[model samples]
Target: MAKPVLLNNITHQHLRVRTGPGAEFGDNQMAAPIIAAEFRQAQAHYPIVFRPTAGDGFEALALFGLAAGDNLFLSNDGWDADYVPLAVRRQPFLIGVSGQELTVHVDEDSARLRCGPDEGEAVFLEEGSPTPYLEQVNSMLFALHEGMLEMTGLIAALREHALLEAFVFEIELADGSERRLEGLYTINEEALAALDAAALDRLHRAGYLLPVYMVVASLSNFRALIERENRRYAVPR
Candidate 1:
């Protein structure tokens, strides 16, 4: 497992926590470390990860070392002072690339927005006027549809009977309250298999799995039987 490292101390409100690895240089990609000083005091470190980006920009990812569990507080990055509560009620967990821009539907009745990606440096969308939170709600629903599809792929690859059965996750709220989420949701394999390409595309267009990241697997944590199989297939060079 990679240990967390300190990145910065400044708490800029516009900070966005995205899912992509930072800029590429030559053939190497930079490690996106966390800024500890801003959120955690000088004492014990909070279970948070920070990745500093170009120009004073930064992104945060909270971790609780959960395997197979769902995280509800992952949407803290998309929270706004006025609409965060509404967002929390709808969908608490989020899955996507860490730093990609997101377009939010601000008006419930009209798809037009008061603001756009160009106006803000972060990954949220808003309108000049306040419509019922319903518009923003729809946007979130759309995003979640996509997120589930991308997450399903990762989950499917990890669902071997001997590999894993449970999960643990961390949830970080806007008010700085962090909670752990751990549970089991019956994997509906039949339903997942029935999904058609068009349904999958709708999820993708809604920004569920944009900016793909690596599907991480821990060799050290694999079951002994699985490890033996991996060794059997290992290429001898």
Candidate 2:
């Protein structure tokens, strides 16, 4: 449960957010929900996979690690990946809808909220206006909100075409131990290739073909993910 409160300049005038990547800020996540709008960028670093929702719908995700709570991309320096998914970037803040208007909400209990003065990026100016950091978070929240809307269409297209398939990943670690990942779903390339001409045209017209292909391209990152796991375990920590 998040302690969400509507962002107010007066009530939260002294807010300062810690923007750096660290496990303390809850960046130790194995996967995060991703929208189709960012597939091109996110696919470059993370494996784009689908997971089934409780309502039987599917949600796209950017996989960060092989095991639960394992984020191999995070290091003492910072996030290793060039492209951090928007979902991961937008932390401690969320967008809320009130009728037709959108509002910003912050998690009061988040570790990213700086406890010491002059410790992190300021959220507001001296006169109570939003700082550059807050402005950036606002933009990111809007993008995420819009991206979620776009994902509805993309998921619809995938469902209509029967393009998603469940899969299980069986990995042999460096220590000869086996790890089996289950309940993950991915694009079915065979079915995609076998689609009829009209189906392909429909997908293309809907602007979903590129993201579909992007999902396929992202699967290559799984090999790199395995390598990362191997390296993490090889180190004498």
Candidate that scores best on lDDT: 2
- TM-score of candidate 1 versus the correct structure, residues matched by position: 0.22
CA lDDT, candidate 1, residue 99? 52
Instruction: Indicate the TM-score of model 2.
Output: 0.96
Candidate 1's C-alpha runs over 4 A off are 1-133, 160-237
RMSD of candidate 2 to the true fold? 1.6
Estimate, for each residue in 128-225, the C-alpha lDDT of model 2 and write its tens digit. 99998999999999999998888888988898888988999999999787778899999999999999999999999989999999999999999999
Model 1 lDDT per residue over 1-237, tens place: 122221111321222222211111110111112221212220121122332335533333333122223322123343211212212333212223435643332121211212344441232224233234434444555555564445344333323222123345444444444545444222233444455797556535644222111111111222322333244346779
Best by TM-score: 2
Q: lDDT at 177 for candidate 2?
A: 75
lDDT of each: 0.30, 0.90
The TM-scores, one per candidate, come to 0.22, 0.96
